[model samples]
Target: MRLNLQTDYALRTLMMLATHGGQLAVDDIADAYGISRHHLMKVAGRLAELGYVVARRGRGGGLSLARPAEEINVGSVVRDIETLDGFVECFDAGSNGCPVAGVCGLQGALSLAVGDFLARLDRYALTDLIPSRQLFAERLAPTSPSTSPP
Candidate 1:
């Protein structure tokens, strides 16, 4: 049940944005998270495409969440970034090489596990991660100049 690095980065970037509640540059996010801008750019592009975030250009432009933190569901974010959730080769739709694939209890158990994972995420919103908006605002204020809008 390991998420890909892309999905990990996407979540991290989203959390940072949620905490900041302001426009954030790709480079700043990369630096803060100690990730590559190249990698973050791909994640950012996907986020923007999915309407999770908005990208702006020019001197006063950067990126910000398309909707408020409270409006975005954590489960939706995970589902959007995940390409596949197969825990075993037989679980994959395109390749079920296992001879007992159709009757295996393992597949059902794994499916339940995945469902539980998503269900837990469904209980949370992006705002749930921040806990305190004032604390996040204070933390971002110091890094504001580097990651600020524009």
Candidate 2:
């Protein structure tokens, strides 16, 4: 199963925040990942709304994780950010237009698969994704000497 760009960005953003363990600007994240700042902003906004992140505006303000890295579950984050209903065309009854909608076993199998996928992800936390925090921080902010792992 493939994750949509929004979910991918959300996971990456969490990883970055966990690695830094400090406030990070949306622009900085965008620059590091070579992603769109606007897209990251929307992701960050959603993360803030969901209580996974804390966003502060104005000078000396930026984005930071609301809780410690170990407290943030990867599966929880994905579930919060993803629309699992659309994993397969037949998963959504109201909008499904597939010809074999009810007669096929694909939908049921896929549903179980999705559940297993999430269950496996539940075993990991944000900290688990970055085994070497210092290395990640260095690679993420190559030229920025001020950035370091906490």
Estimate the lDDT of model 2.
0.92
Residue-by-residue lDDT tens digits, candidate 1, 81-144: 9865556786687977888888879888888888899999999998897788777656545455
lDDT, candidate 2, 114-149, per-residue tens? 999999999999999999998888787745556554
Q: Each model's TM-score? A: 0.85, 0.92
Which candidate leads the pack in lDDT? 2
Question: For candidate 1, which ten residues in a row score worst on lDDT?
Answer: 135-144
Give the residue spans of candidate 2 off by over 4 A: 144-150
Computed on alpha carbons, the lDDT of every model, listed in order, comes to: 0.84, 0.92
Measured on C-alpha atoms, candidate 1 has an lDDT of 0.84
81: Cα error in model 1, Å: 0.1
